[model samples]
Target: MKEIPEFQTERLFLRGITLEDTSSYQKHFVDYEVVRYLADHVPWPYPENGIEEFLKEYILPNQAMSLWMWGIFLKEKPTEVIGAIELCRKGKPENRGFWLGRKFWGKGLMTEAVAPITDYAFTKLGFEKLIFANAVGNIGSRRVKEKSGAKLIGTEPAKFVDPKFTEHELWELTKEDWSKP
Candidate 1:
């Protein structure tokens, strides 16, 4: 089993998820604005049971060379959960996903949150590439990927099943690209 690694940024700490994050998960997952572009498998108003199921079944088991889901916390208030970020491996490459409470949006927190995880996945997990996709209209997310040094790999239509109709845009970054800055 891979142990939880705490990654520090100037103002935040990226740490492993705990049962205590249920409220944070509930807060964001239930929001329509947040889930509108998320994959079909993520249930709306996510079930209480599902939270525990994710931690035990998917997250805990895949930590070694695969999935790593983390709780984003403010450095001064380490116990409080601001949001969640996940680095999931597909074959040998990892992809990114994240959610921030509505209040945290437009604050550059996601950009801060993603960098260290990308670093850890490439530098520590030995992954050479990372990718992230978004509903084509989601310019905010695209900007985050661009700011993280990921290049636009063009859009893929209907690539993800959205309960509400939406198109997805795929983006990618490699270790060589990230190591530049």
Candidate 2:
């Protein structure tokens, strides 16, 4: 299987998620505000063993199967995970999702972390296109997609952790377009 690649930005480092990251993951992800708009799959109150279970069941197996997932960390303090990002092979109006601690909001960190992964998806992984969607009111996520050069395709009902069904704006970025400039 292809090894998951590590990435770096001016201010952040993107590396494969690991069991050692559980404490930091739990520390930053337990905030309601940090996960409010994430998919329903995220346990609302984030169980005590949520990180452990997730790594053992989902992340490790998927990583072995060559899925792309990353733990987002600050360059100065790489041991602490501030957020997570993943590009899944799942079907439908979206295949990418991410969340950052409330403290990291508006820092443009996500946008920086996204660029290389978007390129890896298209240029390295050979996907024809990438799909992204954000809860209608998630302006921060929407901006990240836009900054990555994704085009707003339309809106669709999406499931979220708090509110089961939310209207999400779907967006798309094609490999062709991404290669243009």
RMSD of each: 2.5, 2.1
Local accuracy by lDDT, each model = 0.76, 0.83
Q: Which parts of model 2 are misplaced by more than 4 Å?
A: 64-66, 179-181
Candidate with maximal lDDT = 2
TM-score of each: 0.86, 0.92
Candidate 2 has a TM-score of: 0.92
The residue pairs in collision within model 2 are: none
Score candidate 1 by TM-score against the native: 0.86
RMSD of 2: 2.1
